[model samples]
Target: MSQHAEQAAAFVLHSRPYRETSLLVDLFTLEHGRISVVARGARRSGSARRFTLQPFQALHVSWAGRHELKNLSQAEVPQVMAPLVGKALLCGLYANELLQRLLQPADPHPRLYLYYTYLIQELQQSADLEGALRTFERQLLENLGYGIGFSHCHPGCYYQYDTQQGMIEVTADRGCYTGTDLLAIAEDRYETVDVRRAAKRLMREALAPLLGVKPLKSRELFIKTRRTA
Candidate 1:
């Protein structure tokens, strides 16, 4: 039994070298979830796919296979995609890494795919890049069924996520999320530094267990670049 997809919406999650000149590409697709495919001779000088196949690029792809890894027959840019640079570029990579690490292969997550596309678009022009990422992270967690609570609390109160007890309201703010900040973060109102920091920490806490012991390379890279810059 063979399977085939034609001109399906997709984004390249990661691409790495294979035997000789080929590329083993991981793709997140609207119709088919995460998949791995070999882009034959993509390293050749004239292979335009070498340019088209990359992170944050919107693509329409055609693939066929019977086994897990598919044969990518065609990949084309669906439209003009504005390139993401600097912080936005890094954010795009982080999103890709999250999807690669957390999402299972061959499982369709249409809503998550849509959220991912919107996140890429938002990162392009968002004044608050971290806000955009936090929004995406929240959506990612919800889509994966690890929904974190950020509602129904006092304005000045603080809270934290507890696996055994859900959202636990706490007194001290040192390691807890303030109700005001939580509301703002939940609504994407990243106006204050306090709110932004709280959102970042909350996301880290929620993602830590799912991500396991291994640290995200994206976080390390972001920290290193900020220090040097």
Candidate 2:
């Protein structure tokens, strides 16, 4: 692969201290998809790069490497995003974790990049956080080619979702969903509480296989926050 230095629009999905002063950052870039880079000396006090390497903001980043991990040469925010707080902050982290866990490295997903940018903005301002998250989850799965099917359900009738069998008309309540709710979720309409709750359940079911056995740390954080509150 080419090791030519390139600049791209990006966002920091996750980051952790590397060695002593450097940082290992996972970034989602518009042109390069998900990538990990070593931000040398980023943790040192007085390093200007440390301030610029933050999540929830649009960034212009440049890096160079032939291997999986690149060396981050420059990073700056192209635009500021409103800081997420409270539950929204946790929601943003959850989104980041989902991307980090599910997205393939070095594979560009321009559309999903746009969706993620919008998801952050929605989390910042949307009153319906659950709706926003469910929408993002659906789009993420679709982008990854694991799109859920909602067409098989009979209109106005109750149905159950089988992870392997798709939607099945329900004689008894097997899943926490109605045919109307499934259709609403398909159309991105979570107007009622019932629809939103069902959507969340469906999204969870859809995501389980891809996520495998390891639980998302971000999700665990959310659970703790809820229990405390």
Candidate 3:
């Protein structure tokens, strides 16, 4: 049996060329999960869908398919978001890459979809780029059921996070973090550099297992850009 959707809220995660004049688009939709759709004639200069299908814009897309790859019938931008540039743009790409890698297709995560929308908006406006990335990373991990707990110790204590064992209290010198920093991160209070750094380390540890062998290309791109600049 075939399936069809109308005006589904979505954003293009990534796109690549297909055939002579079409494009294969990966989309993150509110009603559905990650999906691949072929945008016929999207590569053609005169195609209107080509413009509307770019990332960071809110789209109302219609598609149809019985198999994994769908045919993108129509797409229209209901709202245009502020364009992300520099580091924010890289962060946006990183988020998209994470979703494409970690999330399974056809698994609808409405809350995550909303969080992503908010995350993109936050990245566009927030000066705290690391903090914003950490917040979204934490949220994504939590939503995927790998949430880390920070409530195990008192403010003066020290703790270490283990991917297999969660958070564990440790001697002060051996500890990864003081309880104060952990608490701040738990509350999303990334006002200080220390908290931001701790959050980044913790998120890296948490995401490593899920990501497995393949490293994120966006992260590689970011690192390369940083080295050249």
Candidate 4:
């Protein structure tokens, strides 16, 4: 019995050479979380499949096979992001790494796909790198089911974010709270350094519980490695 295949709108999250003439592609689809597809003979110079599978571009793709590694039939970029230079390029790669690491194959996350597209656009156009990344990280966390709690609290009852327990209302002496921190986040008031730092800390803490002890190497490299001209 031959199994049928379907086309999907996707983006190339990452790709690497497979054997001699093939390529292993990690893709994010509008319907699938992260999928691994093999582009046979894509490594040959001047192959249209090779040129079409670059990251940060929207692609229409078709693949077949019931196994984990599907055989890719076609890929074409429908929308192209403007060229990202310098740190922006590295940042884009970091985003792809995060998706590759955190998302499981075959699970669908349509909303996350939209958020990812928006993040790429923002990174391509923005001058404030930190703000753009911070925003995307927040969205990523929420989509992964580890959303942060930044709601307002009573004068004495504070909401402390525990990496293990999530957001909890605790006594002021035992926990931490800034009045309406969650409300501010909900309202999109992420302008100040304090707000951004708070969001980053919350997301990192939440991610710790899920991502285990493995640190994101791309983020570390971004901080430690110097960019070349």
Total backbone collisions for each predicted model: 0, 0, 0, 2
Candidate 4, 112-221: lDDT as tens digits: 88878877887788666766776677788888887775554443445777776667787665336554555555555677876676666666666777777788887777
- Tell me, by lDDT, which candidate is best: 2
Pairs in steric clash, model 1: none
Off by over 4 Å in 3: 1-3
For each candidate in the order shown, give its overall lDDT on alpha carbons. 0.85, 0.88, 0.86, 0.78
Q: What's each prediction's TM-score?
A: 0.92, 0.94, 0.94, 0.87
For model 4, name the residue pairs that clash: 150-182, 151-182
Model 2: per-residue lDDT, tens digit, 1-229?
A: 6678978999999788999999999999999999999999999999987777777767899999889999998998767778899988999999999999999999898999998888888888956788888888999988999888888865668877677777767675655467888889999999998888889888898899999999999989989999999
Off by over 4 Å in 2: 1-3, 174-176
lDDT digits (tens) for residues 28-60 of candidate 3: 999988888999999899998777777777788
Better of 1 and 4 by TM-score: 1
Query: Residue 133 deviation, candidate 4, in Å?
Result: 2.6
lDDT for model 2 comes to: 0.88
Model 1's TM-score against the true structure? 0.92
Candidate 3 global lDDT? 0.86
RMSD of each: 1.8, 1.8, 1.6, 2.7
Question: For residue 169, what is the lDDT in candidate 4?
Answer: 81
Higher-ranked by TM-score: 3 or 4: 3
